[model samples]
Target: IVGIDAAIFMHPTTWKASGHVDNFNDPMIDNKDSKKRYRVDHLIEEYAAALSAEGKENEAAALLASMETLLAKDDFTGLKKMIDDNKMQCAVSHTCNWTEIRQFNLMFSTEFGTAVSSEEGNNIVYLRPETAQGIFVNFLNVQKTGRLKIPFGIAQIGKAFRNEIVARQFVFRMREFEQMEMQFFVRPGTQKEWYEKWKAKRMQWHESLGMPAAKYRFHDHVKLAHYADAACDIEYEFPIGFKELEGIHSRTDFDLQQHQQYSKKKMQYFDNDLNPETGKPYGNYIPYVIETSIGLDRMFLAVISQAYEEQDLSLPAGEAGTEEKKDSRVVLKLPPVLAPIKLAVLPLTKKDGLPAIAEEIIQACKPHFRCFYEEKDSIGKRYRRMDALGTPYCVTVDHQTKEDQT
Candidate 1:
């Protein structure tokens, strides 16, 4: 299927059709003294971790269990009580002066066009909070136009915005970020199989990066979302902790059905294949969707963290001198396909046709992949710089190349 780039701004009613208007919210609370707000789950998680750090293992576990229970029940009063009972304090206030937990909408809103008259109502617009909705709205159009068959996918990479109250951990959780999302359409009962397939495939893709296997684990969602029948996260062990790097969800026709209801449009597919049981064509039905959504910035941070290395080139303990004891280099050992710069052309010296040879090689190879040519620094220093930039290959031009054309 052709890739899609969804518009960042859609009709205001688009969100309402997608259920973001009524349900896409985070529970947040503020400190009365400092007026600092925090997402309820983040606050509770931080407090629970602190409890475990203080060696209160059982207490932390119980607190987390209760918090989850309260959250599932939507018992905001009990949630606030739990926070107050545990004496969770704000980072700024240092006191347990907390206000009641309230639901906060995460979508950022804006006005679209200027009104020409006083009678004109405000033309409110919203930045899309997720790319999946865009995919849902366009699924039928692409499926019929491209003649895509069942089990086909529509993938997109686009920016999304959220008014995150507790946006922290750098790019892990940001107000504005990009997402790479794919929604696979399939028969209603087959979504589970497809969901599992994508879970394994996505994990395999991450493992192929050659990072340690111990650093990744699948975290199945204990509480499914409003639209998801099954969901799980591909979590990577970042410096902060094992956070979600990608998500795989089985969304069972909720998105398409909602849009159909709101827009009065038929979002159904006509399957001509005969159903074995009834010996009749399965016709006119909404398809189940299996979605794999990867956070682009989070994946970038994860790759960078995994590729960075501090290598020790010092001699062996028994066989070497102490002069080279501290010899080391910092390198970004990125894979060739993913590295930003693929090749570096270095000249051994500024003269003797060496720099000219490097430039010739650069001209020959520049079209295929990114190339960097340098003669300002020593060869060793230039190599180090290329390593730091994560260039996977370095071609050094010297007098030997001029002699033998090697």
Candidate 2:
């Protein structure tokens, strides 16, 4: 809702107020032999998976359950002992020699200027770990500028960075990634209602994208952030497994309140809308936020993983069923709206003015959406190629089209 790039480089204290300076950390362990650092949870998970693969299902489950208990309480000693006891080894080093688990801050910090020094701590700034803070800091700017009332949202898509100790499956957890976030501010007592509303709406959106509802489910948070009173993740069935694709949270005015205390600026909204209980204006107060955040890269992974398919288009046709079947075709049956290319215009032959007609079709479709034109391949080959590229449809221009311009 606000201008782009308006808050990329926020003041250093903005993060301090947002709790990133102290609270944004992941428990990490180092492999003494391999000299690699890994998030403690990830290390335990890998070891547990190995146990499962070895047919020690009960052991794996017990290990995972204990790991969660330790993680929830930030039990470093128990975490270390758990690893040592299980003989967990580094995948790289294949050795059990490991460093003690410690909290590692995920933010990537950098010197801000030529004159910046460690003594001048103000110069040390961090790349934002999340985009929600930007929206929170700019809360007043957007509300006043847009003349927005209560129960309005500020939407932003921006790049955020984190020094991930464990980067997992391709683009699943990256050091740098884009986030699509919306911070919906509402009357203080209305957060729970808005949280449930946005949760349903977001799940509906995922299903409308041609993915089956069975492939998605809600995962509630066991431990909430300091700022969040309620939170849950929308997990999608990815190729790797069911993982978080989006997060919905009820942040109960902690952000705006913190900013007000730190920045000495009032973030209160004088709501004129009457409350049903009091029949009076909600009056001046910090607005609670219901946030919906989706990782753009993770969404891409979800879409492509679900869309990709390999089909055997071959059929039994000859007598006695002795005929050879056609080779299987690989297609990305992407939803038409999400496909990179909407149509592929293929000329059946280079001669008989077929290529010219195909060119004409391309010109018309190109303005509306992406269109691919080619005359070098056979019609069947071109169709296969388009399917592989996730083009939703293909049109073959041939000699018969010249008869009546059809």
Candidate 3:
């Protein structure tokens, strides 16, 4: 449950052995006429969302299924046909003639040594693209040193890079972003049970955030990854549509086994006592891993989208006033826990010591929470400004406050 910085310099070997060195990439295609590069998956997802918005849910579902099938099969022709049939226009180009998808490496390359005397071993280094490798590499070290029991998990929140071809939809898929991930260690034969537990736990975590249950769905992966026995994504309904925000995978010792073979090291745990039910040496076995990974940026974006609102806030009391004079305002309506600025201090008047009082209040509250003080324009304008910035509370200092008995 505790968060720690997973420092670099400890995971390069893990990345290399995990096929991340070769496979941590996305297929990007460019429109010849538009000179814009796009990640094919993103483009298709946008098209799907648009179809749904137009009340064409059946068409949207069919298009999404077809796209998934084509992507899994790597059938470029079929993918293009799906896009054409759906009238998928490039957000960048607004045209249908997109280029054939090409692989784009996500890892960023760097050199370790001097450019002049760089020898064969000194040339290439890559910025770690994913933080999962760090957890995988440290699995045995943590268990042995921290004395962590099996069935416990290591949770990490760290930066990862993807060199996204199309970094759009605000912060959904950025080139550099943060990830919150947990890798749970379990007995080899009992991974299925643990996997189900972790899946429920992860879903509960999302539900605790207070988003609608209907807007989130479990998408079981039809095609499994190299390491996964079973996997499912907790897809959230974004402003765009339902898409993956978090993934839960049952990785059955593939990571530890790969690293052990590649590094020439044994990664196994020993147990002193035997299980009476099974009655065998409970010793020296690589634990199966159940992983729950969520992209922080995507989760933040989903929260913002869900919380953003435009509503008629005019009270019935305001009906007595003219339509132009009626009090109606657009409010961000962000949850208090996630509001960027929790409080805003406004001076009722610029002159008469109100500004000074507001400043004093700001100084007092800044140590406790994020706050803003303003004396510009009218009090109503300042409140409106704070509302636009998603400030949850606005406090105005007035002449009455300056005359406090205390």
Candidate 4:
């Protein structure tokens, strides 16, 4: 619970320093039979999961292992061979005919000026693929201004853009999305410890919202990024399957180092504390970073998937008739803190000062939490409406309220 400063920045140079211009891409493959494109990794994962669900554990393991090996080696030919050997068919086409794999850049770029030209690399600027770079470039500004020390963090929530070749699965994968990220600056050689600490901390935060612990798990990356020394994902079991919901990476001064080199400016921090190895004060050096980046849109989807339910109400006892009515209603059992409507004030009847009393209660609770008022519908109907909206509490003002203080 450290105090951290938040900031937002947008600049073309930030992307250049972060290597998004050169390295932000996904392995894409086309289903020639269906004339459709799909991300290679996602397709493989889905297929493997289906095999596992169908009680083919050995086949699923082998397929996933082969896919991982080929991806690690960056062997596009080998990947295609694996697909062909397994007779993997596109979900849409139901055929094994596929085109060659290729790298597809995800960044969305546009011209900077009105002087439009069809030529490549003509004064181009890009929408940021991630929000971490903005925090990195503004490290010094925040540190100096906020008087922050080592182990401090910078956090932000903002929109990011990516030109996904095949954006599917609702809001889980989209051309534009929101990211909630925090970058912690810690002393070098202590990154491994901080990385583990944040990994556990973030997982706890997710589970605190009443989600079952079994629905979440840690997935360590077999292939690490060039800038990262260690990395893992907090994978959530969504309706489709387990997928990455957040990432925690231990970056060893990579971002600050790159920005220093490209901008020709020093991005070092001086620590007054004594270094154990040298038995002297820790001087100027670039601090290593531990980043925690989560997809805000994906988190929203996770909450909805868990909260939404279609419940069937059992018939009353002793009412054993063939024509007995069966009842059902949709409800959102959202966490109280995240629910849109916290409290609903309903008047049983619109006459005889009941509406006025309900309005008074609504005015009183509105300042404390979100409140909704309704008087047009039946009491049962109003309760059902509030239940659908995930309102945890409701107050009904009726004739009894005028007689008794309760």
TM, every model: 0.90, 0.89, 0.78, 0.90
Q: Which stretches of candidate 4 lie over 4 Å from their true place?
A: 1-13, 92-94, 116-122, 276-279, 312-327
What are the runs in model 3 whose C-alpha is more than 4 Å off?
1-3, 9-12, 46-56, 80-99, 115-122, 310-330, 337-406
Give lDDT: candidate 2, residue 131.
89
The ten-residue window of minimal lDDT in model 3 covers 317-326
What are the clashing pairs of model 4?
none
User: What do the candidate models score in CA lDDT, each in turn?
Assistant: 0.89, 0.87, 0.80, 0.87
Instruction: Give the Cα RMSD of candidate 4.
Output: 3.1
lDDT of 2 by residue, 202-314 (tens): 99998888787899999998768788999999999887668899999999999999999999999999988887889997789999999999999999988888888999867
Q: Assess the local accuracy of residue 352 in candidate 2 as a C-alpha lDDT between 0 and 100.
A: 84
The global Cα lDDT (0 to 1) of model 1 is: 0.89
User: 3 or 4: which has the higher TM-score?
Assistant: 4
Per-residue lDDT of 181 in model 1: 95
Task: Give the alpha carbon lDDT tens digit for every residue of 290-369 in model 3.
Answer: 99999999998888887776656655645655443345666776777778799998888889977888888899999999
Cα lDDT of candidate 3 equals 0.80
Query: Model 4, 354: alpha-carbon shift in Å?
Result: 3.1
lDDT of candidate 1 over 194-217, digit per residue (tens): 998999998898888767789999
